[model samples]
Target: MTRMSKSESRHPVRKFFLFALIAGAVVAVRNAVSDKGGSYDPNEANER
Candidate 1:
């Protein structure tokens, strides 16, 4: 028979979801930064 511990068995799913979330955030940020015609002008807010 095989043996499994509670902590060891629970780690993979949690790790996979965490990795997936981080990967998704990275892709989203890359897409946003790569877009054109979008600019952030802090002075406009200050003028108001």
Candidate 2:
């Protein structure tokens, strides 16, 4: 059998964090779109 190289090793923790970041962004956008204003306005947030 062939041995796996160091670079070929799986990084579960790294992959998990990456997935979480993407998922969080998706959820944030979804929530923003479904909110009362129906959109996200960075300027309005900054003005608060």
For each candidate, the alpha-carbon lDDT, in order, equals 0.65, 0.68
- Let me know the TM-score candidate 2 reaches against the reference structure: 0.53
Q: What is the C-alpha RMSD of each candidate to the true structure, in Å?
A: 7.3, 7.0
Model 1 residue pairs with clashes? none
What are the models' TM-scores? 0.53, 0.53
Which parts of model 1 have CA positions greater than 4 angstroms off? 1-9, 37-48
lDDT of 1: 0.65
**Cα error, candidate 1, residue 15 (Å):** 0.3
Which sections of candidate 2 miss by over 4 Å?
1-8, 36-48
Considering every candidate listed, which one attains the maximal lDDT?
2
Model 2 lDDT, residue 31, Cα: 73
